[model samples]
Target: MRIYAHRGASKDAPENTLKAFCLAFSQHADGIEFDVYQHENGIIVFHDRTLRRRANAEGYLLETPWSTLQTLDIGDGERIPTLNETLGVVPTNKWCNIEIKHLVDVKRWVNDVKAALSQSQIAIEHVLVSSFNHHWLKAITDLWPEVKIGALSASYELDCTASAKALNAYSVNIALDAVDKTFVQTVLSEGFNVYVYTVDEPKDMEMLAQWGVTGIFTNVPELAKRVMAKRASAKDAVSDKS
Candidate 1:
């Protein structure tokens, strides 16, 4: 299973900052996952409806211009990065999962995201676009059909698999709490990749791997890497016996 850092090794550094992202890569994560929002200045990397929780600032990201938002230091002297800057951090071999956190405008966001990806000069396949707003994903599909998209759902009732198919999503990014053997099998049987989010526990990671999850989003990339290494070694030993 591939391991993606949730907001870039968020457990170690401030979430969604360049430091966190660089730390994620150093910690051996296969990919980096971060949230993005389109504002007047540009597409900026951030999560949450407001900046209060992480940045200790008071303002709606949607209403705030990038200049004003960028001035607020998230942590360790890291300002919020633009989508272009964030994309620059991803190596060609690694994947970048950009989650659309808010929809100021679906069409406009898709255009800006596409532009940023184009500017990054990375292989288009290396980036996976995901969003809880299926509508926005659908718009992305219509506009940038070649880009891989994932349908994100925290609720099992949302029928992520079906919705993913409808949106032409390459994968379904579901909440870890809703994942199980049955759920993973159900989605896999439909020929869609399954990726669960924010997994931090070793037992849970092992279980998800056993359930055939394609990837996991985690806060502790180093820990997940260590756990996966052990899992791989154990599997190899079993195979050798066979």
Candidate 2:
């Protein structure tokens, strides 16, 4: 299974900051995942709607201007990064997952993401835009049909994966709590890739790998890599003994 750093190596650096992203790549994560919100005039890479948890500041993120927001220290002296700034650090060959936390203009964000990718020279096929708001994803697909999309969900739907099917999603990005052996089998059976989020526990990682999950999002990408490597070695040893 591929390991995507959840908001970068967030366990080590400020979530969604450039430091975290660079660190994630250095740690050899398969990809990096970060949240973006269309701010006052630009898209900023940040995870929370409020600054309390990340910045230790006041007021909602939407109400704050970029000038003020940019000055606030998130952690380890890491300033909030713009979409372009974040994209600038991504390796051309690694995967990129950009989750739309909120956006008012789908077209603008799409253009921004496109321009950023072009500037970074990252392959369009290597990127996946995910969101719980399937309508926004639908809008994205309508605007850029070639753009890959990942359908995000916190609940296990009765339809199994109608949301993903509707958008022809590249992957089904789901909450860790919502996935199980049966759910994995069901989604895989339907031919959609399954990616679980915020999986930091080794046991959970092992279980998800055993269930054939395409990837996992975790705060500790280094640990996730170690666990997967160890699992692979054990499987090889068993095969040799057999």
Candidate 3:
């Protein structure tokens, strides 16, 4: 199973910073997931609508200008990274899962992302767009059919399989707590990939792998690596005995 760094190794470094992303890459995560929001001038990396968690400021991320957002320290002297800057910093080999946080004039943001990616000459296969807003994902898929998209859900009440089909999503990302072997099987039976989020424990990683998940979003990429390695070693030993 692929292990993606949730918010770029958020447990060790400040979430959604260049430093965090570099740490995740160094730790050998298959992909890095980060949240994106459209600013007045450009797109910036952050999870919350308010900047209080990352910075001392008390305003909405969209309300603040890019320049002001750039100045605010997101713990440990790391500043918010723009989408272009993040793309430049991230290695070409590692996959990037950019989750759109809000849905407002996403056409421009989608166009900008596509334009920036086109200019960089990076492989399109390494990027995947995901969002909780079904309409936003639909819009992205409509405009950029080649780019892979994932339907993100925090609850099981929504029919993930139906949503995936409706949005033409390549994968469905759901909360770790809500997923199990049956859920994975159900989604896989429908011909859609299944991935779970924010998995931090080693036991949970093993369980998810056994459940046949395609990927896992984790705050601690190192922990995920260690767990995966252990599982692989154990499987090899069992095969040798057989």
Root-mean-square deviation of every model: 1.5, 1.1, 1.3
Candidate 2 lDDT score at position 32: 95
Residue 85 alpha-carbon offset, candidate 3, angstroms: 1.0
**Model 1's lDDT to the true fold?**
0.87
Among these predictions, the greatest lDDT belongs to 2
User: Residue by residue across 164-229, what tens digits does model 1's lDDT show?
Assistant: 879978998999887778889989999999999989999999999999999999999999999999
Show where candidate 1 strays beyond 4 Å: 158-160
Ranking 2 against 3 by lDDT, winner: 2
Error of 2 at 73 (Å): 0.5
C-alpha local distance difference test of each model: 0.87, 0.92, 0.87
Tell me the lDDT of model 3 at 54.
Answer: 84
After superposition, candidate 3 runs with Cα above 4 Å error:
119-121
Q: How close is candidate 1 to the true structure, as a TM-score?
A: 0.95
Poorest lDDT segment (10 consecutive residues) of candidate 3: 114-123
